[model samples]
Target: MSRTAWRWSRRPSAPSSPRSRPFRSKPGTWRRCSGANAVMSCRSPAGRRRHRPPEEATMQPEPITCRLIVEAVAEFYGLSIVDLLSHRRPQRVTRARQVAMWAAKRLTTRSLTDIGRFVGGRDHATVSHAVRVVDELRERDADFRQQTDDVVLAVEATARTLARFHANGPEDVDPVAVARRILATPRGVPIVSIPEITALASAVSAQELTDSSKMMTGPMKRFRSEPRDRESEFDLYRAVAEVLEADRALKQAQWTHGERGAQARLDRGLKALRETFERETEHVD
Candidate 1:
């Protein structure tokens, strides 16, 4: 018998079976896979599982409810809902309460009637009245408008954060201080105006350029030989004009000469002018 060489060929190994199929993820971690199936599994500490896609999170929370809104408004303004809902007409308290009611209406989704009931059991009409009053006041009073705006913004921001928490999400919002800073700029005031700029420039120039000659001149000297009871209006006017002219001349001389020369000339001129005026005025009196 001839012995023929026999070769053994290795066949492909059988495919391994998947022991455990992909598991379902928790409520927030569900994602679709290539197999067209939803997978729900968090990565293990041992790093055996594949990474999961992050879920889209909600931003801010829903606005505050009517009741909570009223409470927040009351707390911010230091007034009870009862006081706010009251029919009392005291100016300060009434104004504060009206502002609170107005804020509650604006910051919540509650119906007007519901908001009124939450705020001291007021009627819808009362709430409407309050809001109107506050609106009118805000139009007229800058301080009141600013105060209301601050409280409303704070409450609304907090409400939004709470809403985000309820939705199991996070939101990025600018801080309240940033909003306040933006709003704090003075309203209805121009940043620059030609008339105002010109006026300011003129004032600055006047302050910088002061004539010093008049200050260096000696005081006017007056000599009256007799007491004058009354001087005519024309005579008074002429005397004043003469004194003013002498003063101008003294200043002009002072501007040109040294202090000693200016002083001597000013004194002599003032004395002679004073003597003449006094003598004439005494005769009239």
Candidate 2:
């Protein structure tokens, strides 16, 4: 009979050769040891030694984005991206939509409500229902489950491809140039409506509530508590400023470069956002 000597030490575990390694714990906190002993964690619950490759244990694939997942799922199920996002409910379109919801929920950090917004403007409850329906169908029908799996697999592949492309894409791309191009676009970019808000707050006299008001002159109007309070809310001021700047640029582009519809929709969306906010200003409690 031959006997083998195994030396175990407090170091990062590896499939080959015992060597010094940095533990994932606090710096210089690992115990130093040397002997023909094995790490207890090296053994599985079944009493078998388990070894995993470094990549398998520590390397995680980049997160797949919601957009890529939606595109891939739609393509895999033979549905157009429009059909996937549309309010239509043909059986085939519905299945693809459900699978898309499932994939977005599984692969992205976006909330159910966000998933709903992307997938046909449904609510979080609708997204939850779609996910549940897909789960039950996967459990009850093998073919349906396989189809869902295929979509998921396809999405994963698409994400990896996109990750690779982005990783290798231009590192020196100029953000200024990008901004110029977008601002110069005749139709402009897609618009996201600003939050509809009423008066942010009403001016109220604090004198009624506190003696401090007596020391102060005038109504002690409830001015903003903090000058920087707007920091927490959407930067409507900055956005409006940007739109104004963009509008000026667009007008120049139209005048000099013969651009048309440069600020048509963009101007309308900004105006609506401002009007809504002005009308919905918050009131004193």
Leading candidate by lDDT: 2
Off by over 4 Å in 1: 1-57, 80-89, 164-285
In candidate 1, which residue pairs clash?
24-40, 25-40, 25-41, 61-160, 61-163, 61-164, 62-163
How many residue pairs of model 2 clash at the backbone? 6
Residue-level lDDT of model 2, residues 6-100, one tens digit each, is 33444456575345554456654343221112343454444456765444355455576655676687668765554566555568978888888
Q: Per-prediction count of colliding residue pairs?
A: 7, 6
Compute each candidate's TM-score over C-alphas.
Answer: 0.35, 0.40
* Model 2 TM-score, all chains together: 0.40
lDDT of 1 by residue, 229-278 (tens): 45544454455565556545544554365645644654555555556555
Candidate 2 local distance difference test against the native: 0.54
What is the Cα-based lDDT of residue 253 in candidate 1? 57
Query: Which stretches of candidate 2 lie above 4 Å from their native place?
Result: 1-60, 167-285
Q: How high is the CA lDDT of each candidate model?
A: 0.54, 0.54
Give lDDT: candidate 1, residue 25: 67
